[model samples]
Target: MQEWQNACQIAAESAWGVTTDATSVQSMAYDAVRDGTSLKSQHAILATHRVADTLRSITEKHDRGWDAPKPRFTSPTVVYDERSMSFLDDGTVSLATTEGRVSATLRLPDKKDGYQQQYLDDEAWEHTQSTLHERDGAFFLHIGFKKPAEPSRQPEYGTVLGVDLGIDNIAVTSTAQFFSGSELEHRRRQFRRKRRRLKETGTRSALRTLIGIENKERRIAREILHRVSNGIVAEAERYCCDIIAFEALDGIRNRLPAGDVFHSWAFRRLIEYTTYKARSAGIRVTRVSPEYTSQRCAECGHVEEANRSSRDEFVCQSCNARSNADYNAAKNIGERAVRCVQQSTQRTSVSRYALKSGTVTPDEGFTPRDGGVRG
Candidate 1:
């Protein structure tokens, strides 16, 4: 497996060095490296997929008028397709390697309700591709499966839940729920301090400790994100929300306050996690422009920088309405999503915004009314 990974990495580097086009990179890379490695034809071809993916990413950035550096594969994983891999009835997987074919026992999860079990039990899902991953001297196989998606609910009749992401508060919902980032930030600071001390020590043992610390920090962040995402989905479900909305993350760094540390990837991951979870609950996720969401008043629709008195407090200058800044922004995001869906070409009828009190049409504005359907 290690030999296969190393060969794939070299082939990917060669492919990336030769061509920038994703369509032809696979064949060109295969032709160049097929004679060099003992890997089977299909396995060599699969290795070029990594190079093609990187080139496609670079091309997308270029199309968006952004500069992106060439990707360098530090630790490449070997990809296996049907031709190079097979699952036997004896609970073993036959995989093509640089040293030739090898069979390994498949370690099925013990949990009956686990994702692997659920997919394996479902006849509708068909196995697609799988990747071999190496971590801490252990090898694991990640299998992929695909099935038809359920029909989406029409936005015209959907209830929208807005979510605001920030540095201080990891996430804030229009429903008045907040996930604080204080603990995460404190843990990150501690990790940074420990890493600094380890670097100062400049010992082999210290370097190993630093690596372990980094891994632990990643695990902590991932766990927190999962919990926060789950909570966000649960909030939407509690309100019977059909759509979950968020501010678009493009140019988010510029929108944030100066000198504030932002983890763009974390925010993106949160959105991705929420999307998959929401889909399972028959909810759709959408994004709206971030422009003035923080400044705009959820009550009077007033837009002013003075409305936000601090990182945590939002006092509307026009109506003197006081609330958490993140909550206010979330409301604005939800309102924008409602407007967007209402104005969409697919929406021929009036669309309503979901609030804690009830649902209101765009004509009624965001004002709270008495005695209506509960959100």
Candidate 2:
């Protein structure tokens, strides 16, 4: 039981105001408390003291700077399996474990219910798959849970499934999406127009209203990403691919900042959610260096930036290959991931040998050395 894990579990359960008994918290600490020498030791209160010291530093940084104090503690805090030491009147809570429920980290609660099963509003809370950070007074919860165990992943026959993510399209797979960007883009256009008008006013109130618009846009993009990415992953299962690849984001959010007021890009968020979803299904996700998958001919690997003219159209300069922009990106991502994996296997640290296994002969199954398995 690592100390951090101990702290997080306390945070997660604390969301429901369920604290491990205070008596339990103290009893565990009793040995240290009884020994005067230990209690006076510098590392005696390492868990609580470290966070408090951090909080003070954060407060000082904000106090000296412009703008309001920074937010480090988050709304709806919870730490799972963190040993419960104490819960103060303030939001801060102390935690501990016996052997220690160290595996659990504090997180926003994600309970399973009929609503999630049916995919109701899609805005409901879900579990966090891995731990993240808590800095200053603000906390961030990575709002999705590890996929449940029952939906067993069959060994995907193919090793590649292509993925493409974009601002307008959100995400496009080798298989086309049932949903289109028409409605969402319309809303975005309307907001852009309104935002333009607000900018013309050039007043502080107008600036404030811009934040609301930015938040609304984020809300819309997330809603779209959540619904779409899940569907895409479920669909990829049809191909039985063991590996899924997406275009490397490459600081794309910075490339397309939604003006000064609104800035977070939900496209990246959708990919993150999808990556976890795929991982839970025992599928590998690889991000290849996004050089020019769309512009370069997927057929000849022709490198040309001019090949991609419109959001939908792709025309190669050298090889005369052409395809939809998203589809081309998806295919390139798949091919690149495959090549990268092959190269990795050939690296010096690797032995270049894999055990030939099970009900088949030594060379019966597919081999990467057989000039690249397209499947």
Candidate 3:
């Protein structure tokens, strides 16, 4: 894994500042393969293609008027597709290594609690992509699978669950559940203090220790996020929620002062995990604009800074309503999700009538029934 990561780092560094095209970079990868870089040709191509994709993403973000910085490649995982890797019925994965094809038995948690066993046992699941990487002192293979299609049942309660994500409290829900980040915050502070001390000492041992600590903290954070996201899915299932709504927080840090710190929080990762888990359980996730969500009062539709007197307190000046700021934001988000669905339904009806009358073509911005277009 370390050797593959080293190869990827070299490939990424070579591909950057060259071009934003995958095919072109892939040809460069072919050249590297011909030069016998130890890794298999397919592996080298995938690594170069990954770098190309990353560069393209950064370029696109910059074109969209974002001050996106050039991405650095320090340690990158080796991505393998079906052509390069195979998962057998016995739960063993055969991966193409530099030396040749190698097989590894995936270590998984207990099957009794429906952990990784579902994916391993399901015959209907199709392997898609996998990543091999080394973290701390362990090597892991992260695999992706696509399950057979099933009819998704609509939410029985016909209600949307609004989730407001914040740094202080990881998540606040319309159902009045708060996922606290107090412990995470305390640990982060402790790590920060230790990191500062280590940097000040500037010893080789301290630097190595710093690396271990950082990795440990990252692992802990990911575990906590997974737990929180799972709890959210469970809550939605318990309440029979059809839709889970969240803030479309694109470029949010840029809008807020002292924003770099906000970037450290894994808000996007939390949303991603919640979305996939929700989808697997037949619930849809919706994103609403974050503008004024915190400031707007859920009770009276009051919009003003005064409505949020502090980070944690929300009081509406119009209707004299008070609530937890995050909770109020969640309620507002839920309403927005409901409103969005209503508007989409209206548009669908109009489009259907137009189509029947031959007044308009489907190519002219008619939204699909899946509700892909949103405000």
List lDDT for all candidates, in order: 0.75, 0.50, 0.69
State the displacement of the C-alpha of residue 117, model 3, in Å, after optimal TM-score superposition.
25
Judged by TM-score relative to the true structure, which candidate is superior, 1 or 2? 1
Residue pairs in candidate 1 whose N, alpha carbon or C atoms collide under 3 angstroms: none
Q: On residues 39-125, what C-alpha lDDT tens digit does candidate 1 reach at each position? A: 677776666765666665564454334677766565747778767887777878898876778999988878765678667668798
Q: Judged by lDDT against the true structure, how good is candidate 3?
A: 0.69
- TM-scores for candidates 1 onward, in order: 0.56, 0.48, 0.52
Better of 1 and 3 by TM-score: 1
Which model scores highest in lDDT?
A: 1
Which is the winner by TM-score between candidate 2 and candidate 3? 3
lDDT of 1 at 350: 25
State residue 355's C-alpha deviation in candidate 1, in Å.
2.8
Where in model 3 is the C-alpha error above 4 Å?
1-157, 251-265, 345-375
Candidate 2 residue 183 C-alpha distance from true site, Å: 3.8
